[model samples]
Target: MDDQQVGAAAPLAPTERTDYAAADSRRLKIILAGEAAMLVAAVLVVFVLKIVTGTGAIAIFAAIVTINALIMTWHVRVITNRGQHQARQAPGGK
Candidate 1:
């Protein structure tokens, strides 16, 4: 086999792979939207709590928000891992 044949037979670099680009873009959009929605929900929850329970409730509300943020982060991690696994298994994927 010639050098040209060997080069042509080489696998594409991970960055050069396009099999999952579209799906990855969609997943990224979903994650971003989900995170934004979560933030909005947290703010609304805190606002409601304050309105009904006064400033003294802020600490509890903040704690709840923190827990929710942690959960959201975990969800993002799951989404990323699943995407990476799928990409690795796809034809011509990294």
Candidate 2:
């Protein structure tokens, strides 16, 4: 083929596309489920400890559970934000 025809017929470079909808949906569902499970377990444990011990023990257990919940929430938020930022910076993302 002529130089012009060869150049014109050259294949295009591969382009990247982010399907945010599917990925975001899946990630959100998983995060929600995990958070819910963690909260439920924490509540159950606190209740059990309260019943087995007393008011003072319940208070301590509740404080620990609250701290755990906060930590988990912060972790999830940080991870989610990082994923969103990366996706936005990716090629073809707006």
Candidate 3:
């Protein structure tokens, strides 16, 4: 194989891989935290301030919950992918 091809095929060192995974986990955590904060703020706006009422309020909450669910779904996929990558890099992995 050419040098470029060989380099492309090489796996990341354990430290680099760990650093990447750690960064990804941290980012996901930050995103989830932000989502939580936003949901709390929405609650305050809808219920405490009474800015929205009845169906409108319900719709707002539903939208926020749906967005949160989508983010959680993506988060799970990222975690699963990371686990699979780690397993593939382990000794005796096929």
Model 1 regions lying over 4 Å from their true place = 1-19, 90-94
Q: Choose 2 or 3, whichever is better by TM-score.
A: 3
lDDT per residue, candidate 3, 1-94, as tens digits? 4434544546657776678778777877887888788778877776743444445777766777788778778887887687677758644444
- Model 2 residue runs over 4 Å out of place are 1-18, 90-94
Better of 1 and 2 by lDDT: 1
lDDT score at residue 91, model 1, on the 0-100 scale: 49
lDDT (Cα atoms) of all candidates against the true structure? 0.70, 0.65, 0.70
Error of 2 at 85 (Å): 2.1
Residue-level lDDT of model 2, residues 18-40, one tens digit each, is 45545665777787788778777
lDDT of 3 at 51: 49
What is the TM-score of each predicted model, taking all chains together?
A: 0.56, 0.55, 0.62
